[model samples]
Each structure stands twice: as C-alpha cells, then as structure tokens.
Target: MLFEKTYGIDLGSSSVKVYSMIRNKSYIEKNMIAAKGRKIIAVGNEAYEMFEKAPSNISVSSPMAFGMIANLELQEIVLYSMMRKIDKILGIGSVMYFAVPLDMTAIEKRAYYQVANGHWLRKNRVYMVEAPIADAIAMGVDLENNEGSMVVNIGAQSTNFSIITGGRIIISKKIPIGGRQMNEAVCSEVRKRYNLQIGTRTGKRLKLVMGRLADQHKQARKVVGIDSVSGLPREEVISAYVVNAGIMNCVNEIGAQMKVFLERIPPQIAYHIAKEGIFLTGGSTRIPHIDTYLASYTGYSFNLSDLYETSSVTGLEKIIHDRELRKWAQPITQRKL
Candidate 1:
C-alpha cells in the first residue's frame, strides 16, 4: 500500500494556508502570482512583492478574487508551488481537505476538485469542508450541540456572514466588501484630502497602522506618494482620523447588512446568538476596536477570535486530525455512473 499524508488547505484571496498532519505545522504565503505573458515569474510572497511595482510587461496579481478562484491555472500553479515547498515529492497520494465558501456554485466547487486533482496533484484525494463550519470548530464551538452560532468572517476581498446549528450551516452570505474595499477607500480619502495618489498596498499599510473605531487616537504616519497636483513623488503625513474614516465607511455598511441579516433569522436563533455573542474572525477583524465598533452598531456583543485569518484553516486542522470531526468534511467528487 502506498503511504498517504493528510493536508488541510484554506485558499484565501490574500493568502493560502496549508496544514500538514505529519509535520503538525501550518504554512501561510501570499496567494499571488507574477507572470510575463504565459510564462510564470514568481509565486507567493515573492510575487506579492512585485505587486503594483512590476513593470507593465509583467503582471502581478492574486489568482483569487472575492474568496473565489478567478484564474484556475494560476491558482493550481500557486497550490502546487506551495505544496512542493512542504513536501518535496508533493505528497502524491495525499488526502486533502479544503475549507470552501458555502455560497459557491457547482462550477466554482468543481474548481476546487480540479485544482487538487490537476497538474502534479493528480494522485491526491480531495474533500470539502464548509469554511464557516471550519471557522466554528476553530472558535471552539461545539458543532453537534450548537443551538445557534453566528460567524462573520471578514476576509481580504469579501466578508462572509453565516449561521451554524447542529453541525450544519443554516444561513450563509458573502458580501463583496472587505479589506480590499477598505484599502481602496483609504486611497480615495487620501486623494481627496491629501492630494496624494497612493496605491492600495500603501493604503493597506496606513489602514493597518492607524485604523481605529472607538477611543480614536491621534496618530500620523509618513507616506510617499505621487502628488495629485505635480504628478511627482512626495511625502505626506496621513492621520489616523483620515484612515479610520475610510475604514468605517466599509465597516458601517457591513454592520448595517448584519443587522438586516439578524432581523430575518428566526427568533430562537437570535436568542441563542444573544446569549452567546457573535463569533468574529478574519483578516480584516484585526482593525483596532473593530469588535467594539460592530457591537455598538448592531447592539450585540462579539466574541473576537485571535485566530483571525487562520480560523478556517485551524478548524480544518482539527477536522483533519480528529476522526469524529471528519464527518464534517464531505467528499466533493462523485463516482462515475
């Protein structure tokens, strides 16, 4: 019998996370790719470095957008490249578990299978675990007895709000607003106020360094950008208030939508959610006092998860190692008729 390894994967728009059962370790890297026409130049962090800096001849971009695979070929390339780094032989006979979005179409779901079974990973077996289910497990929610659990995952390019009960997802929603939009918002605000043109990456840095909701701090960071007037590079001091203003625009919209979602759900679930605060996890949740801000907006407390971006992958890690939790991961490929 051939030896087989187990792996858990979460392919996020910002990054790709993988857990190796044998090594008992998880690896994360930017989910980016740089290519010159059809030829690949770099993948992962190296490619991310080239983003917005690469010459016009070279294209640097994420293969994923809005938590979905936009470029299957590039996505496969990224997966294979990352896996090869973990296992030199690429774990040819590995059993792979993927944390996937619940709102995906059949074609989008099939893309996961294609990526796992394509290229150098053809010998691998693939399974699907709903991203929210993985998130709940990672948040220490007891899936089997879950009366009602709310999870709002604010990812890089999108936000997913979901409800899970009795080990199943009852409601799931994916909104296009996320960290990316916040970054763009920052750029817009900067251009409007500072008369400086900055890239989304720079906007992202400003957002992370200064974004705040409650107890607003007066902080400033020096950033270099093209002056909108002269069209020349210049350094400017960007204040926290400006950055937070941009971030809050997106957060307010998300909170408003959350309120509507809560209103439509059953009262019983709302009761349980009220008793046990909403579970919040995602990369975007790292913004300072975002939980407090959300609570203020929705009038419901939130249980902030430190796991952040790794929540879903961490849940997949547990599901991969725990036999009892294995039931939550379903086989994606059906047997041929």
Candidate 2:
C-alpha cells in the first residue's frame, strides 16, 4: 500500500531508530531498547539506563548485529511494541522508509520487507535505501549537480564507506571494524595492563573519553572495571597512548580500505570527493581526531556534518517526498523481507 505519510527507521545495533513525518513536519529520533532471552523488557531511555546500570537479572544485548536483523522474532516483537506505543504517543501512522547496509544481499533485503509489511496495524510498506545515499543527500550533495562526495559512517557493527555522485549512490561497502571492536580492544588492553575486566559500558566510555589514534591525543583517562582477582570493582588510570594503540589498529584498517577504494575510483569522480572531501556520520564520528587520523593516511580532506546523527533520517525525509525516489525504490512488503 502507498503511504502519504512515512516513518523512517535505522534499526541500529545499539538502538531502534525510527522517525515519523506527516504532510507538514517530522523529527529525527530513535529509541535504545534492551533485550534478553528474546524479550524486550525495556525501551527508549529506560533501555539506555540498562547499559551500565542494570542488575544481573537484566542482560542488555544488541538486537541488530553486523547491520542486519540478527533475531527476527525479537526484532519483530520490538517493532510491533514500538509501533503500538508510538501510535498511542503520536496518534499517527505511516509507511516505513528504512536504511540497511549497502552490503546486504537481495535475500536479506527481502526479509526486512517481510517483517515490516506483515504486521496488522501499521504493517509497514518498506522502502529500502542504502545508508550512504541518504547520507549524501543529508550532506546536501546535489545528485543533478553530480558533485562527487563520499561518506564514512562508523557505527557499532561495521564502518561503511560510500561514494555518491549527482545524488546517486555509486559504490558502497562495509568494513568489519566498528565501535564494538574498539570496545573489545580496550577491554583486552585493560585486562592485560591492569588485570581488570570491564563491561561494554566502561569500554565504550574509554572509546569516547580517552580512546585515541596511535600517536594522537597524548592524555589518558582513568578507567574502572571489575577486579580480576578480588571479584570486586577496581579503578586505574591509563594513558591515551595505550588506549590509542588498541583502537588505532582498527583506524588503520579503515584508512587502508579508503586508500583501496580511492585507487579504484575513476579519476573524474575521485576529483569531486577530493574537492568536496569525505563526510563523516554515525555516533562513532565523535571519537577525537578520527577525521585527522583518516586524513593522515589518505591525505584527502574530510568534512563533518552538523547534524551527524539526524542527517541520514533527514535525507530520507527529503527522499520520501520525492516521486523519483519512490519510483527508483522497490516497495518492500513485510512478507517479502
């Protein structure tokens, strides 16, 4: 079914991303939902609190893995509940325009289609679009102008790089390294250095507050984690040098991939990216000097978006209003995905 109103979803690893736009206006937004044993016990701000604060009875886990729906039943239940809650909260419904990774196959795309379309109330008709294309649009890369631009979106599961020209997505792919990997690397380092075991929360804090690229950000952050020996909590301060060393390995991986993609890009479009430079999005973009690190290796300038978190949704909001975008996108019914 065609929808005059649209709801855009990101369905990220750490969050259930959704936004609604009526004929007049829309907001860029999301909810952090926590899951355990296939049940969604909490959602939104409550779920976010479970990150470092939940009791042992709660095990907060990411529902979306590697940019795909890892648990369909949990995901559907989560979506169904959210839809019902949103309906009550907003008193409006619309079709869903969702973003999936560029690397997902036709089959995976079909699965999203199936779940989104199958629901009874707000059984959504999904319009599938790669994240970066929306990123380009959000970055205001004019497709008709064809001024080339690239976007590097670093998130929990994977880092994605996509090249866009004239408002069309040209090449896009995913690298395995991401925020979770950085968190794990920090945990490994803390274990080796201080004999402390940290949870995902502590590791993520290190990534944000203290994590740096190798030879960048010389300061360190004091970290707290579980005491490996005493089975109690422990605290220790570590230099950015150590944290940097751990996460820099992942940063280097992205740089290497960027160089490879740059080499493959035709000189013509490559010029545009080199001129307009690369755009950075996703929550991971906030890590200190990530752009600087990328620049050091690639020697290509990088641009930062003001609305990094909301840009993708804002871009899709624009797309939803475009007849051309609707025509190019295949309407994915919930049954097909």
Candidate 3:
C-alpha cells in the first residue's frame, strides 16, 4: 500500500505539520533540530525543548527560515528524521503535498522539490500548493464560485495575503512582518522601560495574551533577564501595557500593508472580497483580540479560522481526499521522474 499512502506536509518556519491519510489525523511539532557537530541529537518537540536553554556545543535551530529552506543539509536531516519518527511508512511511493509560500523564488521552489525528492517521497510524487490556497480551503471557502475572497495568514516570520477568485490566486503579497516582529517589539519595550533584557520566547508569551493596547488585560507575568543597569541576572514583572506597547508598531504595520494590498486590487475583486469579508489564519492570529484589531483597519470583518496553525495542512488533506476540489490549485507535477 506504499503507493496508496498520502501525506500533507506544511513546512512552516515555526513548525512542521503533517497529515497522514492512512491514520486520518494530523501531527504537528516545532520545526527545530538540536545537534552537536555533524550528528543530530534530536528533532521536533525534543529539539524545541532545547531552544533558548541549551548549553554551549548544543545548537538548536530551524532548517527553514522565513518560509524558505535556508539550509538544505539541515532540512534533509530534519525532514527525514521527522517523517520517520512520525511513521515508518512515509518514505518511498507515498504521495506528498507541501504547502509552499507565495513569495518564494524559482530557486527556492526548486529547493523544496529537492528536499522532498531527496527522500521521504517518490521523486515525482511530490507536489506543491500555494500556502494561501491551502488556508482558504481549510476555511471551507467556495473556491469554485465566481465570488472572490481574501486570505491573511499571519505566521512567525511573515504575513501572507492572497486574493482567491474562481479557485485560483489572482493576486498575492507577502510582508516581512509577523510574530517575530511583535516579539522583538516586546523585547525592545522591556529593555527601554524596565531596563531588562528578555528572551524572544518570553516576549512572545506576553504578546499571545495581550497584544492589543485597547484590550490590555490587567495582567502581569514574571520574566527573568539581565538587568541593563547592573549587567546581572534579574527578575522583573512585566505588565500588559509593556507587551502591548512592544507589539503596537508591528500590528499597525500589518494593518497598513493590508490596506495597501486592498487598494491595489481591482474593483471587481475588491467588491467580491468586501462582500465575502476576510479570512484570517496562522499562528500569530492566536494573539488576543488581533482579529478585532485588524478588522478596525481593513474595514471588513475578520473571521479567524479554527485550528489556524494547522489550517494549511488541513487544506492539503482536503485536496488529497476530494478529487473534485483538486482544481482549486495546480500541483507541481514531474511526470518523467
């Protein structure tokens, strides 16, 4: 049954998500690997645990960055280990679909095909689907209808915007603003306000709960960092005000970019989108009141999809199982391979 096995892979910058048709379930893990020298010590969840805490000689990092493969060798090790660790029957003959970022260049696209083809899948059985289309399908949008819809995926490294009409992406744009930027904003605020240096993880934690200044909860979180004044380890309590202040600029920038994107869209497509509203998905959307914040700027209601982190893979699963929906996006086919 190797030839019959189907898998949907979302090779995200922050995490790797897999959907197995044989098991009829999806698996997700942080897209990180920990290693010493040439040997891989751990991958996925285990590697994620080492991040920000691992000692010297141990390096933990993601193979993909900004939704593109930055290290092919590391990516090979990461994917090979991740797939096998999840299921032994993943390699060879298994049809694999990858959710690819829209702004990827030709070389970057080829790199993705190479990663899948190098192992874990039959050479030509690897397919590519635009990340936005996958998110749209997961949201259960009627892609076949003449009406158009807009999808906004706010990921760790970037925010992707795509206008889908008749099951195809009419226009797509990617902005280098996402959770990472928000996290940095928080970090900057902590340093400037409290004279404390916090890790990215700590900043992200604050943003997930209180990203909006308007809805700042009366909450405080204990954070450990170096005291800028003393240059020593210090512990401080950070409030929602600090967190919101850190993320305010990044969120505002996202809203401004979305407005510009909509301004460039043709009136016909814009009309359809205004009627259908906007679909918001991605890990960053998990931020509290983010949809409401964006809705204020876009002038359209934002509907946050359930399982936003896994939406792209869910869409891939739908396409693999529903033949009638295959036309929603074309796959990169290699008949000769």
Clashes per candidate (backbone, < 3 Å):
0, 11, 0
Ranking, lDDT, top scorer first: 1, 3, 2
Residues 132-217 of candidate 2: C-alpha lDDT, one tens digit per residue: 87777777766677767788888776888888776577888788778888888878887888898887777887778777554465
Residue by residue across 1-337, what tens digits does model 1's lDDT show?
3357889999999999999987899999999999999999999999999999999999999989999999999999999999899988764667999999886788898789889988767867889999999999999998888899999999999999999987788888888999999999999999999999999999999998888888998899999999999999999999999998899899999999999999988999999999999999999999989999999999999999999999999999999878999999988773520
- Model 3, 1-337: lDDT tens digits are 5447778899888998989888898988888999998888988889988888998999999998888888887887777777786787564666778888876676787787777777544454677888888888899888778578999999989999999887688898888888888899999999999999988988887787666646566888888999998999998998888888778788899999999999999998888778778999999887777788888877988888877789999999999899887765455544422
Model 1 local distance difference test score: 0.92
Question: Using Cα atoms with residue i matched to residue i, what is each candidate's TM-score against the true structure?
Answer: 0.98, 0.85, 0.93
The number of residue pairs in model 3 that clash at the backbone is: 0
Ranking by TM-score: 1, 3, 2
Q: Judged by lDDT against the true structure, how good is candidate 2? A: 0.72
RMSD of 2: 3.4
Between candidates 2 and 3, the lDDT winner: 3
lDDT values, one for every candidate: 0.92, 0.72, 0.83
Model 3 alpha-carbon drift over 4 Å, by segment: 1-3, 119-124, 329-337
